[model samples]
Target: MSEKKSSLIPKSALTKAWLVWETFPQTCYNYERMMGQAVAQVFSCVIYYLYKNNPEKRKEAMKREIEFFNVHVEFGACIIGMAIALEEQKSEGKNIPGEFITNLKTSLMGPLAGMGDTIWQGVVIPILLAICIDLARSGNGNVWGAIIYTVLILAGAYALSYINFMFGYRAGSEAIMDFLEKGILNKLIKGASVMGCMVMGGLIVNYVSAVCGLEIVSSAQTYSIQTNFLDAVCPKILPLGATMLIYYLMSKKRWSSLKIIALIIVTGIVGGLTGILTY
Candidate 1:
């Protein structure tokens, strides 16, 4: 009774096909963070194209692609690059080299943040929002178009994650030298900064250009004094002034980011409540 138990499942055609999909992640982490995101974006675009072109099973395909981009592909490359550097240190019977690891992390994080913000928030999100908003405003409200955009975004995320995990396994320490020689980090950082500045300008116009009544109260019979210096000067001047003030405070006073953030929040709230400043 105990001997010769029959096997419930047998290996067949399905097992062979599964092996290739398992190996895909390894190829994704070979580059630095910016490069990884670029690759993920390309992959996502291709998937989107496929879904757009195909008629049958398009919905399912789009769903799967979106999941890939959002979950496995987005920041996966950076994680992969970090993992690779760590593993390399481990394999050589050496302590994770402090300087190398520190520089590698420092170098990648800024570029990655920039690239992620520019691509995801700046370009993709705005474009999608524009499309959906336009459609809605026109009274068409093409739900499929919105769905397609969403799928594209999610696909990009998943692809990034998958690529990072696998690349981390293969690249380890070697990627650092390659990354530096290629100057990919510098390019990414520069590009990201430009995008960030543009976004900041847009936000300043949209949110920070408003006026508030902060004039000192006068009991005189004849006239009232208006203390809105921002209104007197050019509308653009106020935001720039505020920005410069914060920058000066940080640079001159050596204030930490957290401290600056807290100070700004407190000042803003107090100023709003006390009518000393306006948004």
Candidate 2:
């Protein structure tokens, strides 16, 4: 790519936009809208610039742009920059199809979210925070250590976000086309989904706790259901069963997360009160 083409958005404006997105993406998250409006707001300048002469087209574009969107904010900046570049080229009467952009965003968001969450939330932030918190809690009472660590984290995150945005804009539609042509995007999305499921399964088995309240009484001795049967069969049978039931509720019955959570909360409270669940 040429140097001029690489600088699609001016560096100043792009950096400012990245800061706004980083600071406020979650501020506008709603159940129905998620980050839809926040995303549209982030690229409002690009949208207006691209469709300035055509008010009707601008309205149409903005309308579609603010549809339900939810992605990890850090990596989502990349996709947003790519969208802006695509929109810019489209405004120039390029041969790009609208559905192509829409489908690309839809398909890429999940995988990108998984990758971003794994790197940032699952690993980096936690590890850094743990180490810094240890320093903060050290006997010296030096709050500056925590403050410096936080500033460094913020600076590093900003740099990463900027890099991702610029990379996406420079790569643009061609990169997406390459992924499609090679059939890699689908695999990426599927792999992320599978990995997310596996993680959830492991967490469920490792953390979910329950114990049997029943025991089999015999003439000679009493066989405890939890110690004798459950432990003998499988260690996490209750948790595994609970996880499977929730999965069935979601996959088969199409239950909403809120409803499922409510059900679990109620079940937990009642079970704890009734001594059915040993916790």
Candidate 3:
């Protein structure tokens, strides 16, 4: 029986991998390949490490990883990390079947993609955009807003990938996912969703605007139905309600984005024509 190795993937090797990791989303996107080439690009070093003395084995391993891969790019590190360990084992002639590598990746990427969506889109981008919107409120063409968002996004993206890579690298495989399935990832996602809701609420209040043009005149007085009635009752309720309606339609009813937007536009036009909506 072969003894298990105890050495870590070197920092320098990881740094090289990280460079490919950061750029793959932009450089390797394709309808057919879909980050498959990017996966090959990033993990080439790992395969090289495993087959440094065997050119034919290295070429086959390189070809192996290039098969179609699709996932939210943020989760690539974890997948790559797992691949690294397996490739290393294979290099040591540990008799790990090639099917195990491909099968695990195919099964694993789906969950990681879900997490990546929640983390990268639902939470990270929204929070950053909200912050940038705050800066743009200063009304100076939002140059600073652009600058800040760019810097923060780049930094955040790199940092996020780095942390996930390190964690996945250290954990070595699906063992971490076993712990993740016990509701840890779920709770984190839920907490992030709560925070995302708060930010989204703030965004709706600040960005979404709606008004009722209806007004009633009584003995030398006028009252706007929107400002006097709705706003007085619950500030910004129209925008808030509209936001919630869209949320319900999309989440519960499974409405498409285009369909929801069309509904809103159609409602606005009909309401404007019928005097239901006011400027």
Candidate 4:
């Protein structure tokens, strides 16, 4: 039996891989492998170090890495870390199969994509934009809002990728499976969903405006339905109701956003013309 390789993968190699992924995640994007090329590129240096003694093994390893793989970039760092650890084991003459690593990567893509996209796109981006928009408006077009957003997003993306990579490297696949089996990931997703809803609700109250122009005259006194009735019943009822209606249509009825938007525009025009709804 061949003796195991004594050398360990350097942190610099892993850092380079992470940077490669961040910089060119979709640069080689295609219908065939999605992010496959990027993934292979990420591990190029690692592959060289691990299989430099065997050109055939190095080629095989590179092919395996290039197999169809796609995931949210930040959270996908965990997968990259796991792959590095697995390759190291293989290089050490451990019983790790290349197929096992490939299969694991494929299986993880969807879940990580969901988790990453939800946390970053659905929750983080909207919240950040809301704050930044408010700041810019308050500052009368201050550049700080944009600067803060750019800096924070860049810092956050790299930091998240780095942390996940290190954790996955140290913990390996067992930790990830445990995370999935224990429903911690699901719980985190649910919590993120709730927070997302709260952010959207705040955004709706802040940005979406609907005022009813409908009024009633009784006993020689005028009362705005929006002010006297709707406001008394529930503040911002029109906007809230409209927003909820849009949600219902999109979620339950499976209506396209474009259709909903068109409907809203038509309703707005008709309401304004009929003097029933106003800004």
For TM-score, the strongest prediction is 4
- Tens digits of per-residue lDDT, candidate 2, 193-238, equal 5666665666666557877777678899998888888889988888
TM-score of each: 0.41, 0.64, 0.83, 0.88
**Across residues 114-226, which tens digit of lDDT does each residue of candidate 4 receive?**
99988998899899989887887785578888888888988999999988877778788888888999998899899999999998889999999999999888998999999
Pairs in steric clash, model 4 = none
How far off is model 2, as Cα RMSD? 6.0
TM-score of 2: 0.64
Give the candidates in order of lDDT, highest first.
4, 3, 2, 1
Residue by residue across 1-279, what tens digits does model 1's lDDT show? 111111211223112212222334334444334233333333332333333454553444333222212112344354433433352333335465434544554555455555566666765566565555456555555676677667776676556555653454345536644765688867865776677677666656544543454555567542212334544656666666667677898999898999888987897788788876664
Better of 2 and 3 by TM-score: 3
Cα displacement (Å) at residue 242, model 2: 1.3
Give the number of the best model, judged by lDDT: 4
Greater TM-score among 1 and 4 belongs to: 4
* Residue 276 lDDT (model 1): 64
lDDT score for residue 75 of model 4: 90
- What does candidate 4 score in Cα RMSD to the true structure? 3.3
List ranges where model 2 is wrong by over 4 Å: 1-8, 26-36, 44-72, 87-160, 217-219, 256-262, 265-276
Worst 10 residues of 3 by lDDT: 1-10
